[model samples]
Target: MDAVKQHQQEEYQQFIKDKIPKPNLLRNAVAAFVVGGLICDVGQFISNFGQSYFNLNKDDTSAFTAIVLVFLGALLTGLGIYDQIGRFAGAGSVVPITGFANSIVSPAMEFKREGYVLGVGAKMFIIAGPVLVYGFSSSVALGILYLLFSI
Candidate 1:
């Protein structure tokens, strides 16, 4: 009886697997590349505008560009457009600061109804906290390594 049940389960699993659609790897890769490239292009444009029009230095211009991108990402997320873009672009949407903005805003939006302090504030960092932790840790480690090597 147990053997018969196991055989039935295996057949059901195989049936489900066969029913699932296969992904188009090449197309997905191309879409990700194009979306990612477009995001970089927008950042470049913002940086250029900051430099040419506002006369910002390179460092300041980059900061300005990052701010703009983050703002745009948050705005689009609020408007419900960023998720659509993410669905289409996949990892392309996730590889930029815009994605970081989305990650921060998305959970906050989701948990807002639970209350501000306990919900939005608490959940806002669910995705970004670990990233910040590791990012800072890695940078500090690399800085120390650089100092040691320099010495």
Candidate 2:
């Protein structure tokens, strides 16, 4: 019985290995570029639509579009649809601010189940905190330098 079980396990492993596709570096690089470009293209499309429909200037249109995408991404993340889309689109789904919102909320939601203090609360900002910190710090530093240089 033990020998049969071991043989079956080995065969199953072999079958899985054989069925899996081998990685191709060129294919992966091309796929990543295409998906990333597509994501940016979609964002541009949204921005353009907002600009035309609402008569918003470039900055306002961009802000509005970003807000809309972020809201939609968060909603999709809540509905559990974003994960499937992420899997399908790979870098395409991950290249936007929407993806950032999803990344921040998804892990937080999972950690919430582990308890608030140590789990959800602690881990909630694990992904996004660094981004926020860097963004804020860089902006502040740039502003200070600009002020000093302008004087």
Candidate 3:
């Protein structure tokens, strides 16, 4: 009985290994690099637009650039385009402000059919809530520490 069970387990393990798909690391890395660079390039363009056309100050230019990127990210996510990019580019599409926008919008879009109040509003923060909470909490903590140490 013990031998039979061992043989079955070995066979199952072999089957799992054979069925698992192997990733092309070089290809994935190249794709991520290209996609991530392109995203950053778009951000730079927006910043330049703000600076050159609107004559925005450095701080305002940065704020305008961030807003535009976030809007584009939300729009792409709403249109179901960001997901496709994410599938192809993996971490490339997910390490920027745009990705943060997608994180917030994606869940809201998913829950839209359920009801705006319960679904969209509540579930909207499913992924981003923890990130926001931790981010804000840490910032506050850091600010307090800085104040205490500086005094």
Candidate 4:
């Protein structure tokens, strides 16, 4: 009886495995690499533009680049293009500042119909809140440590 049950379980496992779609590992890797590289290249272009056109200093250029990238990401999300990109590039679309913007905007957009105060405002941070909390807390902790060690 036990042997029969084990055989049935193995057959079920094999049946489930066969039903699952196989992923194209090589294709996905190449797409992610290309898409991620393109996103970085766009960021570099923004940085260069800030430096050359705006004559921003190094720190300001960096800040300006981040702002522009985030804005573009949110704009694309609003326009629904980011979702398409996300589908095609998968993780590639998620390795940049734009992805962070998308993370904030996507939820807000999805919940907008529930009202501004409760829906957009509240749900807007659902995904990013924990990340922001952890990030800020760690930064503060690091800063305190640095201050203590320096003094």
Candidate 5:
């Protein structure tokens, strides 16, 4: 009986392997690279504009660029275009601040029906909350390590 069950499982696994198409690694990598590059190019353009037009210093220009990217990400997510882009670009759409914006806005929109305090506000951080928590925690830990080492 156990042998028969094992044989059946093996057959099912083989069937699944045959039915599922293999992903094209090179093509997917190229797509991700192109999308990520385009996003970075936009950030650079914004930074350049801030420096040239607004006379912002390097640090300020960088901050401005990030703000612009975050805003664009949230806007695209709100308009539902970011999800499509994310589907196509995969990690390319996700490794930037725009992805973070989408993370926050997507849940907020989903829970908006629940009301401001209970729905949108409470659930807004569901996806990104853990990420934020770990990010801050790690940064603080690293800072403390640095302080201790430097002393």
Candidate 6:
């Protein structure tokens, strides 16, 4: 076990060395922080617009934001727009519900050449299904736990 661990560590170190050279740490840090913040900023902008324009409260606004983003993601996936955005933004394109939509649809779209029954139809929900299942289950479990603890 110790030998295996040491070998793995060495391999990881070599991988890192090959991929990323020692650089200006400050510049990388600033660029990462700025880009990540910009992505979140866009998400917040959507939420705010939903709240103000749709007369939604915060909770409703967030839901509206996610739904709209997911819809846009699906549309972009259909139109092949999301791929370009993903390339440009990297984490920026992937930090929202839009990313989730893309993950689900992209696979099915790729497999569509295999025919609907065996391809798109069958595989359409493969990615999103697990996410939906876990999301709902965790929410329910948390709700129950909160209710039990509160009482």
Model 5 bad stretches (over 4 Å): 1-15
Give residue 8's lDDT in candidate 3 (0 to 100): 98
Which stretches of model 1 miss by more than 4 angstroms? 1-20
Clashes by residue pair, model 3: none
Over 33-113, each residue of candidate 4 has an lDDT whose tens digit, in order, gives 899889999999999999999999999999999999999999999999998998888778887889889999999999999
* Best of the two (2, 6) by lDDT: 2
* lDDT per residue (tens digit) for residues 36-55 in model 5: 89999999899999999999
Q: Which stretches of model 2 miss by more than 4 angstroms?
A: 1-23, 88-91, 114-121
lDDT of 1: 0.95
Go through the candidates in order and give each one's C-alpha lDDT: 0.95, 0.83, 0.95, 0.93, 0.93, 0.80
Q: What is the TM-score of each candidate against the true structure?
A: 0.86, 0.69, 0.82, 0.83, 0.87, 0.64
Candidate 1, run of 10 with poorest lDDT: 18-27
Which pairs of residues clash in candidate 4, taking residues 3 or more apart in a chain or in different chains? Answer: none
Clash number for each model? 0, 0, 0, 0, 0, 0
Highest-scoring model, lDDT? 1
The global Cα lDDT (0 to 1) of model 3 is 0.95
lDDT of 3 at 26: 89
After superposition, which runs of candidate 3 have C-alpha atoms over 4 Å from their true positions? 1-19
As a TM-score, model 3 comes out at 0.82
Estimate candidate 4's alpha-carbon lDDT, on a 0 to 1 scale.
0.93
RMSD of each: 2.9, 8.0, 3.4, 3.3, 2.4, 4.7
Q: Tell me how far the alpha carbon of residue 88 in candidate 4 is from the true structure, in angstroms, after superposition.
A: 0.9
Model 3: how far is 94 from its true place, Å? 0.9
lDDT tens string, model 2, 1-90?
699999999999998997888877676667667766776777788898998888999789879888887887889899999898787667
lDDT of 1 by residue, 1-151 (tens): 6999999999999989978888988988998999999999999999999999999998899899999999999999999999999999998998899999999999999999999999999999998899999999999999999999999
lDDT by residue (58-89, candidate 6, tens digit) is 78987887887778788998999888877666
